[model samples]
Target: MIIDLRSDTVTKPTKGMLDAMMQAKVGDDVFSEDPTVIILEERLANMFGKDRALFFPSGTMANQTAIKLHTNPGEQVICDKYAHIYNYESGGASFNSGVSCRLLDGNQGMFTANQVLEAINPDAFYYSQTSLVEIENTTNKGGGACWNFNEILKIKEVCKSNNLGFHLDGARLWNALVAKNESTKQYGDVFDTISVCLSKGLGCPIGSVLIGDEDIMKNAIRVRKIFGGNMRQVGYLAAAGLYALDNHMERLNDDHTKAKQIGEVLSNLSYIKTVEPVETNIVIFELHEGVNEKEFVQKLQENNILIISMGSNILRMVTHLDYTNTMHEKVLEILTSLKF
Candidate 1:
C-alpha cells in the first residue's frame, strides 16, 4: 500500500464532498450571486463570530490579501521567523503590499505578548511603521504547533496599544481548535482578521475563507481581484467547503491521533534523534548524525512511502483524512525495520 504523508494538501475529496459539489447551485461569484459560495462564507463568518468573510482560490492569496488590507507601502508585519507568511508566501508581502517583515525567533513559531511589544516600532521615522502582526496557528514548520489562547489575548492587547492590525494565518486552525478544545469564537475575538483553509484538514477540494470586519473584507475583495483570484461560478468548490465544514471538522482528531502514533513509533527508533511534539496532525523529526536525509527518504520511497526532507537532517510528515490507520501502521513498521 502506498502511503502519502508529504502534506495534508494531498487529500482527495470524499464521495460526500463530491456529491455536494455536483449538486451545488452555481452562479457568477464575481457578481456576488453564487448561493453556495455565499452560504460557505456566511457559515464560516458566523462560526468565528466575524462580521463577514471572503473566499479565495488559495491560502497564499487569502493571507497576502489580509497583509495588504492591514498595511500600507513600506510598513512592517511582525511574525515568527518560521511563519508561512514569511517563508512560504513567495515574498508576496514585499511584492504586493510593499511591506517588510519583523521576524521574531518564537518558540515553535508562536510569540508572546512581550515579543510583540518589543518588536513594534516606537514611531521613529527611521523605522518601518509596524502596522501589522501576523500569526500562524498550528504553525506549519513547527510540527503543527498551536498557540496558547491566553498568549494570543495578551498579544491582542499589545496590538491594541501599538495600533497594529492582528491577522491569523489559520490554515490549520480547525486542527488547532480540535486539539486544544477551544471555541472558534475565541479566535475571532482575538484576531483582527483570520484566513482559514478549506483544502487542508477540512478535506475540501479547494478554497479558503478570510474573515474580518466587513470594511476590511471589502478591501480584501479588491486585493483578491488584483491577485487574479476573482472567480465565476465558484460555488461548485464552495459547496465542497460547506460540506467539509459540516462533516469533516470533528474528524481532524483522527489525523492528530495518527500523527502522535507515528511520533511514538519514531521516538523509539535509533535513527530518529528527536520527534517534535505531536500537538496536532504534523510529525517532524531530526535524523541521527550517521543517517543521510536523501538516503532516508529514498529508503521510504522504495517502500512506497512518501515524505519530505525539510533540510539535511529534518523530515516532515502530515496526516489528514486521506491517511488511514493501516497507512500509519505500515509507516511505523517500515521505520522500525530500517537500518542505520
Candidate 2:
C-alpha cells in the first residue's frame, strides 16, 4: 500500500467530515447570511477565547490578511528566519503588504521577546517603522518544533511594551496544543491575531480561521475581500472545519507518536547522519554523504512511499489523520530493510 508522508496537507476529509459538509446549511457569506459559516466563526472564536473570527479560503490568505490588517505599506514585520510568512508564502509578505521582514535566527522557528525588541527600528524618518511581529508554532522548517508557553508570553510582553502588533501563524496550532497540553484560551490571550488552519492535521478539505478582536476582524474581512478570498455558500467547507474541531483534535497525538516511530527507524539507518528531534508530527533527518537526495527519494517513490527532500541533504516526513498505525509499521519495516 502507498504510504504518503509528504505533508499533512494531503489528508482527505473522512466520511463523517464529508457527511457534515454535504449537510451544511449554506448562504451568501459576503451578505452575512451563511448559517454554517457563522456557526464555525463563532465556535472557533469561543474556543480560542477571542472576540471574533473570520474564515478564509486558505491559511496563506488568512496569514496575509492578518499581515495586511496589522501593518501599512512601507512598514516591517519581525519573525524567525524560517517562518512560513518569510519562507513558504512566496514573498507575499512583501508583495501583498508592501512591507519588509526582519528575519531572526530563531531556534526551531521560535524567537525570544528580546529578539523582537532588538529587531525593532528606532523612531526615525529613514527607517521603516517596525509595526508587527509574526510567529509560527510547530515550526514546519524546524522539524515541527513547538514553542514553550512562557516563551510566547515573554514575547507578548515585549510586543506590548514596544507597541508592536503580534500575529501568530498557527497553521498547525492544533498539533502544538495537543503536544503541549495547552488550552486555546492561553494562545488567544497572548496573540493579537492568530491564523489557524483546518486543512492540515485537522483533516478538513479546505479553510482556515483568523481570530482577533472584533475591530481587527472587521478590517480583516475587508482585506479578505481585497485578496479575492471572500466566499459565498462556504458553509459547506466550514462544516468540515467544525467537524474536525470536534473530532480530529485529540487524535493528533497519534500522528505525533507515529512521527517518533519513524524517527526511531531513521536514527538506526547507516546512511542517516542525524535525525532532528521529532516534535509534533514531523520527522526530518539529514542523509549521510554519498546518499544522493534525488536518487533516495526515487527509490522510496518506487516503493510507493512518498516523502520530500528538503534542502541541505534533509528529508521530511509528516504524519496525519489519514496515516494509520499499520502504515507506520510498514514504513519502519521498509526503512529497516533498505541498504546504503
Candidate 3:
C-alpha cells in the first residue's frame, strides 16, 4: 500500500463522494442551469454570509479571477512573500490580471496591519497603484500556519482606510476553522472577495468556490469565463464538493492530529534541524547539514511512503481523508525506526 502524504490535493474521492457525483443532476453550468452547481454555490455563499458565489475548476483560477475582478491592469496587490498567490500560482496574478504584487516580509505568510500600511505604494504616477490586499488562511508555505483573527481584522481595517479591495485565499480554510475555532461569517464580513478550495483539505477531487457580494461575484463570473474556467455539466464535480462539505470538514482535525504526531517523531530525530510549527495538516521540517535530502526522501519512498521536498533542505507531508488510520500507524512506526 502506498501512503501518499505529499498533499491533501492528492486525495481521491471517497466512495460516498463518488456516489454523490454519480447521482448528481447535471446540466450545462456555463448557462447557470446546473442545479447541483447552483446548490453548491448557494450553500457556500450562505455559509459565509455572502450575497453570491461562483465555482471554478481550481483554486488558482478562483484566486486569479478574484484578483482580476478587484483590480485593473498595472495595479498592485499587497500580500506576504510566501503567499500562494505570489509563489505557487505560476505568475497567474501577473499574467491573468496584469498586476504586480507588493510583497511584505511577514511571519509565516501572515502580514500585520502595520506591514500592510508600509507596503502600500504611495499614490503617484510612477508607482503602481496598490489596489488590492490578499491574505491566505492556513498559509501553505508557512507550514500551514493560521493567521491570528485579530491581526486579520486589523488588516481589514487598513484595507478599508486605504480604499483598497481585500481578498482571502482560503484554500485550506476548513483546516483553519477547525484549528482556530473560528466562524465562516467572520471571514465573509472582512474581505470583499474570498477564494476557498474544495480539493485541498475538503477532499473533493476538483473545485474551488469564490465568494463575494452580488456585483463582485457577477464580475468574477465574467473574469472566470475570460480565464477559460467556464464549464459544461460540472454538476458532477459540484456534487462532490457538496458531499465533502457535509462529511469531510469535521474530520480535518484528525489530519491535524496526525501531522502533530509526525512532528513529534521528527523532533526526536537527530537528522532534523528544525520543524516548522504544525498548525493544521501540513508538517514541514529541515534536515541537519550533511543529511542527504534526496536520499532521505528516497528511503521513505522505498518504504511505500511519499512526501515532497519544499526546496532547500525543507520537506513537507500533508495528511488528508485518504491517509487512513492504518497508514498513519505504519508511517509513525517507520519514522520512529528510521536511522537517517
Candidate 4:
C-alpha cells in the first residue's frame, strides 16, 4: 500500500464530495450568478461574521489579493519570517502589489505585538511604509504551530494603534480553531481581511475564500479578474467546498492525533535530533548527525510510506483526510521496525 504524506493538498475528493459536485447547480460566477458558488461564499463569510467573501482559484491568489487591497505600491507588509506570503506565493507581494515585506523573527512563525510595533517603519519617506500586517494560523513552515490567541489580540491592538491593516492567511485556520478552541467570530473581529482555503485540510479539489467588508470584497472581484482567477460555472468545484465544510472539519482532530503519534515516534528514534512540537496535523523533525536525508526518505519510500525532506536534515509529514487508519498502522509499524 502506498501512503502519501507529502501534503494535505494531495487529498482526493471522496465519493460523497464527488456526488455533491456532480449534482451542483452551476452558473457563471464572473457575473455573480453562480448559485452554488454564491452560497458557499455567503456561508463562509457569515461563519466569520464578515459582510462578504469572494472565492479564488488558489490560496496564493487569495492572499496576494489581500496584500494588494491593504497596501499601496512601495509600502511594506509585516509578518513572521516564515510566512507563506513571504516565502511561498512566488514573490507575489512585490510582483503583484509592488510592495515589500518586513519580516519578524517569531517563535514558530508567531510574533508578538511589540515585534509588530518595532517592525513598523516611521512616517519618514526614506523607509518603506508599513501599512499591512499578515498572520498565518497553524503556521505551515513552523510545523503547524497555532498562535496564542492572546498574542493575536495584542497584535490586533497594535495594528489599531498604528492604523495598519490586519490580514489573516488562514489557509489552515480550521485546524487552528479546532486545536485552540477558538471561535470564528474572534478572528473576524481582529482581521481586516482573511483568506481561508478549502483545498487543504477541508479536502476540496481547489478554492480559497477571501473575506472582508462588502466594499473590500467588491474591489476583490476586480482583483480576481486581474489575477486571471475569474471562472464560469465553477460552482461544480464550489459544491465540493460546501460539502467539505459540512462533513470534513471535525475529522481534522483525528489527523492531529495521528501526527502527534508520528511525532512521538520520531522523538524517540535514535536518528532524530529534534522534533518540532506537533500542535495540529504537520510533523517536522531534524535528523541527527551522520544520517543522510536522501537515503532516509528513500528508505521510507521503499517501504511504501512517502514523506517529504524539507532540507538536508529536516523531514516533514502531513496527515490528511485520505490517510486511513490502516495506513497509519502501517506507517507506525514501518517506523518502529526500521533501523537507521
Candidate 5:
C-alpha cells in the first residue's frame, strides 16, 4: 500500500463521516436555508462565543474573505514571512483585495507583538495603510509549531491599541487546541476574525468556517458572493464537518504521537542533518547542505511512500487520521534501511 504523508488534507472520508453526509438534510445555502449547514455554523460560532460564522469551500477563501472584510483597497496586512497567506495562498491578498503584505521576519510562522507595532506603516499618504494582522497556528512550515497563547493575547492587545483588525488562519487549529490545551472562547475573545478548516486533521472532504462578530462580518456574505464562494445543497459536506467536530478532534493527538516517533528515528540517523521539534503532526527535516532533496523524495516514491519537499533540501511528512499503525511501522522500517 502507498503511504501518503503529504498532508492531512489527503484523507478520504471515514465510513462514519460519509454516513452522516448521506443522511444530511440539504438546502440552498445561498438562500440561507440549509438546516445542517446552519447548525454547523452556529455550533462553531457558539463554541468560539462569536456572533456569526460563515462557511467557505476552502481555507484560502475564508482567509481572503476575512482580509477583504477587514480592509479596503490599497491597504496593507501584517503577517510572518512564512505565513500561509503570504507563502501559499498564491498572492490572493494582493490580487483579490488590492492589499500588500508587510511580512515580519518571524520565528517559524509566528511573529511578536513588538514586530506588529514596528511593521505598521506611518499614516502617510505614500504608504499602504496597515489594516489587518493574520496569524497561523500549528504553523505548517514550522513543523506544526503551536503558538504560545499568551503571545497571541499580547498581539491582540497590540492590534486593539493600534485599531488594526486581527485575523487567525487557524486551519490546523484543532491540533493546536489539543496540543496546547487552549480554549476556543479565549481565541474568540482575541481575533476579529478566525478561519478554521474541516479538511485538515478533522478529516472532512472539504470546507472551512470563518467566525466573527455580526458587526464585523456583516459584509462577509456579500464578499463571499463576489468571490464566487456561494454554495447550494452544501449541507451534505457540512454534515461531515459536524461529524468530524464531534468524533475526530481528540484523536489528533495520536497523529502528533506518531510524528514525534518519526522525528526521533530521523534524529538518530547519521544521514539526516536536522529535524524540527515535532509539536504536532508535521515533521520537517533538512538534509546535509549538499544532499539532493529530489533524489531523496524519489527514493521514497520508488518504495511507494509519499511526502513532499518544502523547497531545496527541506522535506515534510504529515501524520493524519488515515495514516495507520501498519503504515507507520513500514515507513519507519523503510526509512531506517535507506541509503544515499
Candidate 6:
C-alpha cells in the first residue's frame, strides 16, 4: 500500500463523518443562518471560554483574519522566526494586513516573554509600532514542538503591560493540547485572538475557526467577506469538524505515539544526523552531510512511501489519521533496511 506522510491535511473523511456532512442542515453562512455551522462555532467558543468563533476555509485565512483584527496598516507583529505565518502563509500579513513581522530567535520556535518584551518597538514614529504578538503552538518548522503554557502566560503579561494584542496560530494546537494536557480556557485567558485548524490533526476535510471576545470579532465576518471567504451552505464541512471534535480528538495521542516511534527508528539509523524531539505528530530529521536528499526521497518513492524534503539535508514525515499501523510498520521496515 502507498503511504502518504506529507501532512494531516491529506486525511479523508471517515464514513461516519461523511454521513454527518450529508445529514447536516445547511443554510447561507454569510447571513449566519447555517444551523450546523453555528453550533460548531458556539461549541468551540464555549470550550475556549471565548465570546464568539468565526469559521474560515483554511488555517491561513483564519490566522490572517486574526492579524487584521488586532493591528492597523503599517504596524508590526512580533513572532518566532520559525512562525508559519512568516514562512508558509504567502506573506498574508504584509499583503492583507500591511504588517511586518519582527521575528525572534527562540528555541524550537518557542520564545520567552522576555523575547517578546525586547522585540516590541518603541513608541517613536521612526519604528513600525508593535501592535501585536503572535505565536504558534506546536511549532511546525521546529519539528512540531509544543510551547510551554507557563511561558505563554508570561508573554501575555508583557503584551498586557505594553497594551499589545496577543494572537495564537493554533493550527496544530490540538496536538499541543493533547501532548501537554493543556486546557482551552488557559489559552483563552492569554490570547486576544486564537486560530485553530480543523483540517490538521482533527481529520476534518477543511475548515479553521478563529476565536476571540465579541469586541475583537465584531468585524470579522466583514473582513472574511473582503477576503472572499464568505460561504453559502458551508455547514456541510463544518459538520465534519463537529464530528471530528467528538471522535477524532483523543485519538491524536496515537499519532503522537507513532511519530515518536518513527523518531526512535531514525535516531538509531547510521545515516541519520539528528531527529528533532517528536512531541506530537510531525517528525523532522536531518541526514549526514554526504547523504543525497534527492536520492533518499526517490528511493522511498520507489517503495511507494512518500514524505517531504525541507531542503538542506532535512526531511519531514507527518503522522495522521490516515497513516495506519500497517503503513507505519512498512515505512519503518523500509527505513531500517535502506542501504546507503
Model 3 gets an lDDT of: 0.93
Candidate lDDT (C-alpha), each? 0.92, 0.92, 0.93, 0.93, 0.94, 0.95
What does candidate 3 score on TM?
Answer: 0.98
Query: What is the Å distance of residue 246 in model 4 from its true position?
Result: 0.7
How far out, in Å, is residue 284 in model 4?
0.5
* Whole-structure CA lDDT of model 5: 0.94
Query: Model 2 — TM-score against the truth?
Result: 0.98
How well is each residue in 62-121 modelled by candidate 6, as lDDT tens digits?
999999999999999999899999999999999999999999999989999998888988
How many clashes in candidate 1? 0
Error of 2 at 20 (Å): 0.9
Against the hidden reference, what TM-scores do the models get? 0.99, 0.98, 0.98, 0.99, 0.99, 0.99
lDDT of 2: 0.92
Off by over 4 Å in 2: none
* lDDT computed for candidate 6: 0.95
Clashes of 5: 0
Per-residue accuracy of model 4 over 63-88 as CA lDDT, tens digit each: 99999899899999999999999998
Give the TM-score comparing model 4 with the true structure, all chains together. 0.99
TM-score (C-alpha, index-matched) for candidate 6: 0.99
What C-alpha RMSD separates each model from the true structure?
0.8, 0.8, 0.9, 0.8, 0.8, 0.6
**Candidate 6 local Cα displacement, residue 99, angstroms:** 0.9
